[model samples]
Every structure is written in C-alpha cells, then in structure tokens.
Target: MHFEQANRATGRLVTTGEVGASGASDSELTTGRFDGQDGHGGEDGHGGKGGQGGQGGQDGRGDQPWFELWNVQQGLWLQHQLGESRADSNLPLWQHLHETLDLAAFRKAVSFLVDRHQALRLSFQDTADGPRQRVLPVHDLDVPLVDLTGLADPEAEVDRLIRIESATPFDDLGSPPVRVKIYRLASDHHCVFVNVHHIIADGTSMGILLRELLLCHRAFAAGEEPPLAPLPKTFEAFVQDRQQWLSGTQSKSMETYWLDQLAAPLPRLRIGDYEAPADDVVNETLEFWVEADITEGLGALAKELHVTLHILLLSAFVVALRDISSDDDIVVCVPFFGRDTKDLDGMVGNFVNPLSVRMKMSGSDAFDDVVRRARSASIGSYANSRYPFTRLLEQVDAEARPGRNPVFSSAFQFTRFLPPAKQTSQLDLCLYGRPDGERIKLRFNYNSRRLAESEIREVQSCFQAVLRRILGDAAISLDSLSEPLRQARRTMRAAPRDGRRLGRLRGSRSTTPDA
Candidate 1:
C-alpha cells in the first residue's frame, strides 16, 4: 500500500509504501543519502510529483466563497498539568494506506465529498441582497508531510511551526476560499498534520477522505489508476435545499425555541477575588480527568435509563450550576455535528451547530425526569440546528453577557478517535520519539469572575457523587443529586477558598443544601 503526506518544511509530496497485507507491522527502513531536495528515488519506493493546478471556473463567478463554523465555548479554559511527559509510544498501528497515496484519487474523493455536503466547500458572498452562499468546486488538496527529524529541540520546533501557522490566521475574513495548514509535530515520531478548515471539511468527512485516500494510494502503489465515484450533487444543491427548508414552518419553530430560551438574559460569572485593570479580562483554565471506569459507569447508567449520554451529562451540568450559581434555571452550550444526512459523511467541511440547553431545576423535579427533559430538548434542537448560531444570536437581539464568552459558558465533549494505523516496516513509516498530548482535544473557557476552580470542582464532585448514587439506585430522582452538592457547601464553609484574592466573593448563600 502507498500513503501520500505533505512535507511542510519542504512544500512537496512524499509517497511511501510496502508490500504487505491489511494489518502488517511497520519496520524502519534505512535512510539513504539525503541528497535530493525532492524526496524521491528512495530504496523503500516513496516518491511523487505535484499534480497540475485545477482549472478554476470561468468568470470569477465560478469559484465559491469561503465559510467556517465556529463553536465559541465559553467559561474558563480548562488548564492541564504541563511538562509532565509519560513514555507511551503507541506505534505499529496500520490501516489501508496504499490507496490514499495517489494524488488524483485523493482529489476525486474530496470533490465527491464536497459535492454531497453543504457544510463542506460553503462560502459566504456579499451580494446586494445581503450575504449569500456561492458554493465553489472542490479542487485538488495536496498535503505534503515533512520528516522533522534530528531537531535539537523538536518541541520548540513544533511550537515555532504552530506560531507561524497562527500568524497566517485561517483567513476567515475573505478570499482564500479554503484555510489549509501543514502542521509539524513530534509525537512518538516526527510527523506532519493537516487541518482543512471545516469551511472545507468536517470530522466525518475526514474519515471519508482517509478511507478513499487509502483506496487510491493502494491502486497507485499497484501501478494501476483506479476510477473514483462521481459526486451526486454540488454544495450549491445543499444551499438550495437548506434555503427551502428555512423558508418553511420548521424555521419558525426554531426561532421560537431560541427566543424563549434567551428570554431570561444570561447571567455573568463573577471572576475570582483578584481585581484587574479597567479594560482587562481575567482568563483561567482548570482541567481534571474522569477515569475510564467512571466513563464506563456513566455510559452504563445512560443505557439503564434509556436516555442518551448527552442527557445524563446535561443533568449533571444542571446540578453543578445549582450548587455553584445557586440558580434554579441554567443554560449550557452544547455542540452538535450538523451533518444530519448520511451521504454527507465523507464530505470535508464545518457543520458544528451550537444549541443552548435551558432547564428549570425545580425542588420536586426527579433526576430521571430532568434527564428526560434535557434529552428531549437536545433532540428537538438537532432537527432545526441548521440555523447558524450567529444568526440565532442576532435574531434574539441578545447581547453578549459579560464573562469569558458573550453567549455560552459551559461545554461538554466526548472523543473516541484512535490514532492512525502505522505501517510495520520502518522504511515505509516513521514514529515520533514523544507521545501526542490528548488532554486539550476539547477545551472549556469559563469566567473566573463568578466561578473559581474550587467552585467548579466542588460542583463536578457533586455530580460525580450523584452519578454514583444513581448507579446504585436507578429509581432515585433528581432531588437526590443535591446531597453531594450540599455536602460540598458544608466542607467549603470550613475550608478556605484556594485563590482568595482581594475583591473575590467571601461566600454566597443559596437555598440551604438539603438531603
């Protein structure tokens, strides 16, 4: 099988392959003399030339504008324990890379994906009739993987590379119908990464791209040109489809839901006791992990309750708010994969939709009943999630509430992505010396003004305790979740808050924590 990767340091395509089965161990190949600027003529049989530029459409009208989906998570960014390295070199994982190496086949697959999904290859056009979408055609995207080997300090080099990428900024403003980046990292091995701004592809589409790229690379490795499937419809078709849907009754219902949710303006969190300059805003992150067993227990509880994992998590979040904010009503931000269609899976684009989940924590509401409410609200939001969050914010005339973010504050995410399978032959594949840091995969930004690490942890601990209780007693209602939070408040009264700055809240009393 053959695999094609973009070499960032040297903007060139590098191809590598091996004669092996579906799952073979990767053995390192000896490096010959590094003479040629273009990585070619290697004994391991890895080399490729850049393809011709794709023909842009006639009359500037043919090329579509660029678009991006932004999930602005609010609150204090969750910080991690830095500089603590663990030695876990997860190597020798292999996938069908032979087919994904061919440039032609890769482009064909990308086009197929974009043509079938609106979230991929969508552009916003400023026309006389206001901003509109001018969907562009998907062209060949050649990602060159560089081998950043023998660096004095590879981590420094990687950080330098990331800074350079950030400088160019993804051009979310105008032009460059797509934001493309060639990233370099040394995770258990030196490797190059690519993040095709969702304006061009989504997470699921990435899966499609990888699968097709493998097929294409395999065919190329075997010295045979493979024919790829044609796309059924262009992104424009999706735009047209969405417009029709928006003008219908569904749009009205979505607008109504959003308006009602925000009727009570969001409350701003009071930052930590420390005072800041007039124009400065304080930002902080607190990160903690829930072990594998805990995750499994949560999943099991969800299964037993016949509710989605999302609902269970949401209920926990509500309980947290009750403990920390002393508020009965709470709103948490939830991100949804906007690609509801099966055919859009392989398309690369941004389709993240944010939904505001508002729930009322009543004295008598049972835990099971709260889960049911959150679940129903979440599923219903998905049905009309196509409404861009920016649009919804504007329609509701809601001002950005003070705090970390203008709109939403809290976020929830669950990831299950395994690393890319590696080839057995070292000559065909290379592993980095260090492991990849997976802690920052999903981040939450919170306001230190109102909530501190202590408060957040106390709330989280309460939720954990409540979840454990529910695991033992499935019939226990939502009111029962309060015991832990109540216990937390009692403990806090005796223990000093960690970062008690000058102007911070000495403490606030809410409904007494009841058993």
Candidate 2:
C-alpha cells in the first residue's frame, strides 16, 4: 500500500519524539522497558548489523552481509528519510489482539518468531547514495510488559497507549523494524499491540507472524516442541532472486509492457467531489455491505460473463468511476501478489506490487463489455506485475504533482487482508471489497481532505445500487444504472425498489461479448 516518487536528489533523517503529559518522552516509554530489564540484555534482539549501504558487501566494522533494497523499499526509505514518517503514511501496520495469555510464554513465542524470520530482525540505514538493509543475527526478544490491571480504566489506557505508539514514528530505522507491547487488563484479559514497518513485512507477513507466534506459544505452554516447518529459504535469499530478476531481460520486457500500458497523461480520479490541499491527507474509512442474495448474484454474474469475481467487482467500480469523473479512460491500480513461486511461500517481505489496470469505457458500454475490458487489463498487468510500482512511475513519467500519487488516483482490490483504512499520498480513494460468508464487505478508505463524509456515503449508496441493478440486468445502460443511483443518494436512504433481495437475478444467459 506504500506510494512514492523516486529519484530525489538528497534526503535527511527526521527523528521525532512525543512529550507525554507526564513529561516522559514517548521514545523513552517505547525503548526503556526493553533495555534488558526483563532478564535479557539491553541490546534488543532485532538481529540488525552494519553493512555497506546497497553495496551488498560485509561491513568492515564487524557487521553482517547487506542486500540491495528493492525499488519500492528504497522509495519508502527515501520518503521516511525525507520526513514522510507520519501515522498516515502507508507503511505502518497496527493491530490489537485480546486473549487469555501468560506473559512469559507470550514473550517466548515472540522471541521464537523473531529468531525464525530474518525479516522481523531487519534494520535499515540512509546513506549518501541511498538506503539499504541488513539482517541482525540475534534470535531473542525483550518485550515490554505494561501492567494496567488496576488502572481506573484499564481498557481505555490500553487504547491510549496504542494510539500514542501508532503515532510514534520509528526514528531510527536502523533498529528493530518491529514493536510489540503487551497490556495486562486482568489475569485472564490481555491485549497484544503489534506494529511493524512495511519495509520488512507486508499484509501477508502479519498473518504469518501471528500464526507462528500463537503456534509456538501454545506448544511452549504445553511443554511441547513447536510444530513449525523449517523455513529453508530466508528473506535474504528472496532479495537476491528479486535483484537478479530486476536486472535481467525479463525485467526489461516487463518495463516495456508497463510503460506502454500506462501512456501519457494518466487520468485523475475526482469523484471525491471536493478539492483541497493535497498535502494534508488524513485517513477516514467508511464501511458498508451488500445483501447476501445480491452478493450471490454478483458471483453468478461473474460466472456468466466468464470472468473472475475480482474483475466483475472491478468492472462495477469502473462504471461508478466513469459516471462520477466522466473520464473515458480510467486507470485503477490493482495490487497483485508477487510471490510467484513456491520458493517464496515461506519467505515474507514487501513483495506486493501494484498493477496499473487501465480500462477504456464509454456511456454506451454494456456491463459485459466493461467486464471484458477489465479482465483483459487485469491479465496484462498481472503478467507484468513484478515491475516495481516506484520504477513504473519513473518510466510512466507521471506528473509529480503536489497532492496525489504520481500514477493512479484510486486503487481497488478484492482481498481478505483488512487493515485499518487510511488515505495515503497516492490515492484519493481506495475501494476494497471482499467476500464475507454470503455477503460482500465493502470499505471505502478516502482522503478526508479531498472528500466529505456525505460524499463517501453517497458513493456507498450508488455502489450498492449498481450491484443490485447489474444483477437484474447486465446489459442495463450505464446511464440508467448511474442516473437512478445518483438520484437515489440525493433523495433518501436507499431501499430495494423490489424489496430486500433487490432485483432478483434471472437465470444465467450469454453475457459473453460479441465477437
């Protein structure tokens, strides 16, 4: 989800700290507990060591081997170096988990995870040339156990700490790229706050870390060896492979393909219905859902049209965008999974890449026609998806405008990977939909500076209408679908004209595009 423009001339590190009401620096609260107070020594076990910046050589000062960073990682590092290290930046992952847990066993589980995953132990540095990373060699963790059992509002205090820590930027990227805080609310109630920078972990890595940690914790609690598979291939190995691929002819072909896919003057997404200073982006997410039967109809429509459910959802999004922006040519970046081979199955890092899925639409286009275009575009982009988005921005020569991302204004993805939504530098709106049981969970993460809460709600209403109208008829005119929905928003809270099921989908027919 990280976005940035590359090729900056110079960068400077920005170290930030928060002065709490108690006058203790938040950084002190952050690192003070882990300075070997709990049996382990002060050198926290993040496994970081000094290395040649991006040179991939062992440091003479007695550190470890360095790996040349990927293009997206370098972009994120440069942004961080130049002071884009805000809570709204699309680089930090924050989550809180509650369960009955023993502190010692939890600490042991985290320590085991840190040892097993080299990515969790990574550290970065900004050099004159650029930023690079190296893996630390340690295998243990010193977790700060914050006891809030007797506080007047223990739950509220845990929430406060999470907010403060989530806002607390990682000043020194050269330290451990991960932070873990355990808040004890009661003997049986606990909260686990985990924040990891996107440099070493993506959405997928979050699941891997938690799953492995819980597995290890259960085994330790039972005095049994953890039943975990050996990670034969480490993150460093994947880095080498990626660097090799980025240098070869395949990369050249991919660059060529993307450069052609995203031609000049990429269209802007102005559907947010307002314009403000682009620099002042804040994250606001509005969530809604489509009825279960209509969700089934969407699946049925995709099946009838011979396209994946993702493409179908994307086509619906395109219809909505064309209506609002009035742009015949729309580009929506679709983030793709880049762990191509099974060798990378065990390795986790920043491997997700954005595929620029450009669709050409007209008011006269049918739902089937839009889906065809979307499907083709998704296929084309996925084929060349490994070309880093930052590098693609370079070749695409997108305007490095003050407010928005250099490439696409909006992004859409069908994924189960749900994080707290926020607006970033590159997106005006990020529309995500995933299947939840029989229903579709839709979340619209928007930049509040560019969009109003009412505007976002209108979008949700219109999108719901689109989903329903499409089921009743895929060949329904775009204008028919749009005008009715737009009016639906202005009038009142939308209810199904034909009841809760919306328009009941008829039996499947030939939605295939005309040859």
Candidate 3:
C-alpha cells in the first residue's frame, strides 16, 4: 500500500509503500501518484508558468472595479463602530527563533508572500453603493527590524514591543492590514512578530504565510529560486465563486437548514456576577493546559463514542455552563476553517466562519448522551456552515443585544492546528504548542467587565474537574457531580441583582459581549 509522509527537514512530500497483496515493486511504490501538484504543473513534475503574467478575466487581473466585500467582511464593517478598541479585531502571531535569521532574505520572503497572495495587499473603502475591497498591486514590503541587542533587558523590551504592535490597529482604509516586525535579541537569536487584522486573515492564513515565508527565505539565503507552487485560485476568485455559490440552490438549502436550526430564541447563560457588558468592555485572557493523560482519556472516550474531540469537549463545556448558569439551552460560537476545497488549501484570507452551536440540556442527561446529541448538532451545523454567518443573522432577523453577541455571548473553540515546521536552516524555530507533557492548551478570553478574573479561573477549574469526572464515567448524571460544581450552577442560577454571584461585577452592565 502506498502512503505519503512529509519530510520535516524540507517541507516536501515523500512517497513510500508497504508490501501490498499484489506485491507491487519498489520502483512502482516510489513512483506512485503524487497529490501535491496544483494541476497546472508540466508533465515533468514541474509547475507550469502559464499564469505568471496578467491573465485577464477570473485571474483577478481584469478591468474589474473594486471587489465586493465578502459577507463576513461586510458584517465586520457594519459592526466596526461597536468595537472597544482597534486591537479587538487584531490577530497577532509571535515566534521566537533560536538562531540568527538573514534580515535581507527575510524581508524578501515577506515581499514574496505579499506578491503571491493578493489578500495581504487588500484595502477596504466605502463607496456610494457600499463597502468594497480594493486589491492593491503587489510591491516591495519593508519588514521593520528593531535591534534590541543593546537594551538592558532585551527580552523585556521584546515583550513591550510585541504589546505595542498587538495593540496598534491596522488602518484598513489607508494601508494594507498586515505588519511584520523582527526584534534581534542577540547575534543569533531573534523574535519575529506578525500582526494582521482579523478581517483579512485567519489562523490558517497565518500558517500558510509562515510556511511560504520560510520557504522563500531559505531559497534566497541559498542563492536559489524559491520552490513555491502557484496557487490554483486567488482569494478574489474565491470571493467570486462563493458569491456565485451563495446564489445557487445548494446555498438556498443550506440557508433553509440554518433558518430551522436557529428558529428558536437563543438562551443566554448568566454565569458571571453581572449581565453582559457593553461592546467597549475590557477583555482579558486566562491560559491553562489540560494534562496529556486527561487529554488522552478524552480522546479515547470520543473515539469510543464515535464523536469528535470537539464535540466531546464542547459537551463538557455545555455541562459546565449549565451547572454554573442553570440554563438548559446553551449556545457557543465555534469558528471553523472555511477552506472547504482543494483549490483554497494554500490561499490566504479571512477563511474562518463562526457558527453558533446550540445544545438544550435538561441538566440531568448523562455525559455520553450529551456528547452524542452534541455530535449530531455539530454535524448538522458543519453541513450548512458554507452559508455566511452574517447572512444567517439577517435571514433569521436576529435582534441586536446591546452588550452581547446577537444570539450568544459565550464562545468555545477547539483549535487543533499544528504550526508549520520551520524549514530554514539558519533559524531554530520555537512554534507554539502544548508543552512536553501537556495535551491541550486552553485560552479563556472573556470580557473583564462582565466576568471577574477569579470567576474566569473558577470556571476553568470547574471545566477541568467536570471533564475529568465525565472521562471517569460517561454515564454519570450532570446533577450527580460533586457539590462544588453543583453549587456553582445554583449560584449562577440565582445570581442577585448586585452582581456578586460569581464575583463583584464592576462595569456598565448595559452592553453585552461581542458575537
């Protein structure tokens, strides 16, 4: 049987095979089908240079005016006024490399990435008709390099610089929404930070960009041409195709499914001391990790029950929220990687769609039963997730809630992405992931004005405790859990008007959390 494995040292596909029943030869095994080609490759296993020039029409080089804002982009534009700070929509990725990087090659790589992906050079403008995306021509991008080697404490200076870059919002109207900064800590050690507006890039896009940047940098340092494949489709082409699909029968069917699924009014969970705070509420993040053993156990349970780890964990989250808030109906917004086609696999853009997964628990269902139900609900949502979330809100005519998301305030996401392996020989990259003995890293981002830090930590502890209990016995009832968990539920259920149930609520309670 033929199989493929990625050569971590060189980010290339290598084909190998096990002895098959037919006794295929070694040569045959090594010459098996290679699925990495973009279909625009020549017969000699090299990519064709057909679309290198200005290929008019759908190639995104035609005389088309400003591109229409994608459904999600339009929604973000409409709600831009509601954000507390520009950083609210900023997505920053920082990397610590153990070796010195070639500054010139790194800058060229960044420019190469910008030239390859049109989305990185996108700018938004408001016209007489509506907001549109302007695809700017590719040009040289100067990656800002800060030499902090002479600072008293270079590491602290790097931290300060990261905070500044993260907090500074991109001017989407005036310039490209992506920024790259490199901080040199020593002759060989460096820190790289890349920040992009969430409207233009998603988690997957960051990975794509990093992989290409490393590839280009390595090639440049070696005085060789970059071995990057041509993208089968551009983000602009994706936008056009998506619009066409949204006008098709399949989109109509998806819309119908979403409409029925979201017909009922969403139930809000009041777990914290206060109600949902306004859009301007300050947000904070609490980070924790689930041990490898518990994570392994959860995976075993999920596999045994024929459910995904996401559903299993989501079920636990719902149970915990129910115990804390006494809410039977729960809705948690989950973001899915929106690249559904092979053509879009290597493309970069805001290809993330958040779907509100609602679960109605009786506060008495068994853990296994909840997992099963959640699996079913999640599968249904995934099927229709191609529909724009903004369109769903408009179709359902969801009412605006001042301080919370239109339908749900709380959000849950299981980001199972593995960062691309570093290919540059010069840099020893340290990518973000669970530590040596950890299984899952949990980041809790919540509005500090609505939920106290203590309350958030308590919620994390309770979630961990509940997850352990469920893994121990999937048949256990939610109400039959330990007293602390049960008491948490009761406290949230009967929260007093003074906002002291979870803790002392301190912000203006008129607004709600962002969706």
Ranked candidates, highest TM-score first: 2, 3, 1
lDDT per residue for candidate 2 within 368-424, as digits (tens), equals 888877766665565555567766776776777775676677877776544454434
Clashes of each: 68, 2, 10
Best by lDDT: 2
Which candidate, 1 or 2, has the higher TM-score?
A: 2
lDDT per residue for candidate 1 within 1-515, as digits (tens), equals: 32232111100001111112222211111111112211222110011121112221111224445322232210000100121110011011112121123344444544443333434444544457444444445534444544444677765775566445423324341332332333233433432233443334444445555565455545655666545543333344434454455666656776787777677566433323423222233334444455556567767888776765546766766665655555566666654455544333344444445656677666567777777777655554444455556556666655543222344445443333312222111010111111114221212233444445565555556655666666676556555556655675555432345546322442343444532
Give me the runs in candidate 3 sitting further than 4 Å from their true place.
1-50, 54-64, 79-84, 98-101, 150-152, 273-276, 288-296, 417-439, 479-484, 487-499, 502-515
lDDT of each: 0.42, 0.63, 0.62
| Superposition error at 343 for model 3 (Å) | 1.4
How far in Å is the alpha carbon of 341 misplaced in model 2?
A: 2.2
Task: Tell me the spans in candidate 2 whose CA falls farther than 4 Å from its real position.
Answer: 1-62, 89-102, 272-275, 422-425, 479-486, 489-515
Query: What is residue 389's positional error in candidate 2, in angstroms?
Result: 1.3
Q: Which number leads on TM-score?
A: 2
